[model samples]
Structure formats: structure tokens, C-alpha cells
Target: HREAHAMQKDWMRQSGIEEEEKAPSIDNFEKIAAERVHLGLLVNELVLSRELKLDDEKVKTKLAEVTNAYPNGDEIRKMYEQNSELMDQLKSTVMEDQVVEWLTERSSFNEKEIEFKELINNNQ
Candidate 1:
């Protein structure tokens, strides 16, 4: 958590986003973190969009798969269709996912196996 907070603060400074007058309290950290992550995704999507064309049908299909995981999937789908804001947000998320997938496909990485305990200890 401390590492995450530090990273968030660093990102805000580098991205020219101003923090509030008060320090971010524990109660608001989750919201702040979510906003930071969302902004990062948007930026990444913008860069990826310039390099690769996105298909609207793929976005819709992914959204459908996600929405169907919920019990009220039909209603949720209707809500997105009826609300432009929600629909746009869904499209943005789907596009980001596509961008990530594309990048992953082209990237190479070395997998290092580590114990769960070691991973937790390292993070701490």
C-alpha cells in the first residue's frame, strides 16, 4: 500500500495533476488510486490507437461478455445502450484492453518464479 501511494504521488507530479490541499487520507486513497489508474489507461489507449486500428464490433462483444457475468446482465446492457456516458466508458475500457492485448502479443518477457511468501515480503 505504501509503495502504491508513493507511485501514485509520483505519477501525479509527473503528469502535472495537482493534488488536493489536504493529504490523501486512507478513506480517499481508493478513489484517488482508481482515478489515477483510469487516467493512465486513457493515455495508453490514446498512444495505442495511433499505432493500431480498433474494431467497434470487438469492443461490443467484449462488453457483452463482461456484462453477462452479472446476474442483471440484460438490464446492465440496456443501461449502457441507453446512456451515452456509460456506453462511452465501456468502449474506452474495451479499447484499453485491446491495446494491452496487442502490446502483450508483441512483447517478450522472462518469467521468474517466486514463492507467494517471498513476493509478499518483497512488496513489504
Candidate 2:
């Protein structure tokens, strides 16, 4: 366990990810783990979409829907419309979501349920 902790620290250093001054709670780590899993799924979906030659218009439509769902959605949409960088980021995120939807329609997964505690411990 000590070696693993050291390796994690080393990896953070190598990746230029700074360690927090205070250790994160288990819940915080769990949240991080969940986000990593989400990102991994999106990456897998993006690869699948590329292989299938999928159109990205669905993503754009979804992004518009999402923006409209927000409170002050018009202002939000205007902000994105005015800011190229934010617009690009929004587009990328929407594209990833679209890919995930397409992949879900075509792929099957084997599933097993595990306790959240077990999931967190196993990740550690």
C-alpha cells in the first residue's frame, strides 16, 4: 500500500498534476473515480463513432436543447455564441455525448453490481 501511494504521487508529478495540500476524503476520491469512468466511456464512444462515420448534427441539436434547458438559457446561448473558446468546448462535449448515445444504441454490455465501497477500495 505504501509503495502504491508512492507510485501515485510519482505519477502525479510526472503528469504535472499537483497534489492538494489536504488529503481528499473518500467521497471526493469516489467522485473523481466516477468522472474518470465517465470520460473513459466518452472516449470509447468517440472512437466507435469515428469508426462508424457518424454525423455530428445530433450533437449540435442536443447542445441546443441542453442550453435551452438552463435557467437564463437565452443569455447562456448568447454567451456561447459570442465566445469561440466556450463554444468549441461546448461543441466537443456535445459531440462526446452524441457518440455515447450512438454507441449505446449499437453495443451490449455484461453487467455485475458491486457495492460503492468495494468499487472505491478496488480503485485505491
Candidate 3:
């Protein structure tokens, strides 16, 4: 990866691409932070409005769905079961997905195709 990265950098230099490609400005950082906070607030509001609750069954199901994707599914499941922090994180993730699913079901979206780099580097 190191050699590939160096080659990529050389190609970028030769192509006259600026070195600040990955360097985001302060405004971008602020915008990203603000968007995160806004999303958090929206999720919280949705949870409270709908009285959504995360039950143990839901967490277990989500954990199973995730661990089953790995080769050592039982090992990963055991680790998540034993670790309170990991379980909590998983619970949060489950709740986030629940919120997103609710919004997606209730909302309309306009789909368009674009380059992957444009989507990821949009904030910059």
C-alpha cells in the first residue's frame, strides 16, 4: 500500500493535481460537525415522538445478523455478549438503523448516479 500510495502521489503530481485533495478546510469540518449534530437531534426527536425502544431481542437479532457475516461467527458473538461497551455500541447502531428505516419508509427520494469520489469528497 505504501508503494501504491507513493505511485499514486507521483501520478497526481505529474497530472498537476493539487496536494490539498484530502485536506478539508475549516468550514468543511464545521459543516460536517453541524450535519452530525443535526442528524442526532432528528433521531432523538423521532425516537421520542414514536416512543421507540430498543429491546434485548432487537439487539440480539442485530448482533446475530452482523456476526453471521464473519467466518468465526460464534467467536464474534461471544465477544459481543461479554463486552458491555460493544453491546452498547451495537445497540446504538441498531437504534440508528431503526430510525433510518422509519424515515426511509416515510420519505421520498430522488435517485441519481454519480462518481463515487464525488459523493465521498462532497463535504470538501
Runs in model 1 with CA error above 4 Å? 1-27, 34-42, 45-49, 70-72, 113-124
In model 1, what is the error at residue 40, expressed in angstroms?
Answer: 2.6
Q: Which ten residues in a row have the lowest lDDT in candidate 3?
A: 23-32
Model 1 agreement with the true structure over 1-124: per-residue lDDT tens digits: 5545766576667777686444455445667667767777776766666666667898789779878999999998888889998888787777677777877888999999999999999998
Which pairs clash inside model 2? none
For model 2, the superposed segments whose C-alpha errors exceed 4 Å read 1-56, 109-124
Better of 1 and 3 by lDDT: 3
Q: Model 2 Cα displacement at 77 (Å)?
A: 1.0
Candidate 2 lDDT (Cα, whole model)? 0.67
Cα-based RMSD of the predictions, in order? 9.3, 9.8, 11.7
Candidate 3, 17-112: lDDT as tens digits: 776565333344455556666886888899999998877788889999989999999999999999998888799888998888888899997999
User: In model 2, how many backbone clashes occur?
Assistant: 0
What tens digits encode model 2's per-residue C-alpha lDDT throughout 68-122? 8998888877887799988776766665666667779999999999999999999
Worst 10 residues of 1 by lDDT: 19-28
Model 3 accuracy (lDDT, Cα): 0.78
**1 or 3, which is superior by TM-score?**
3
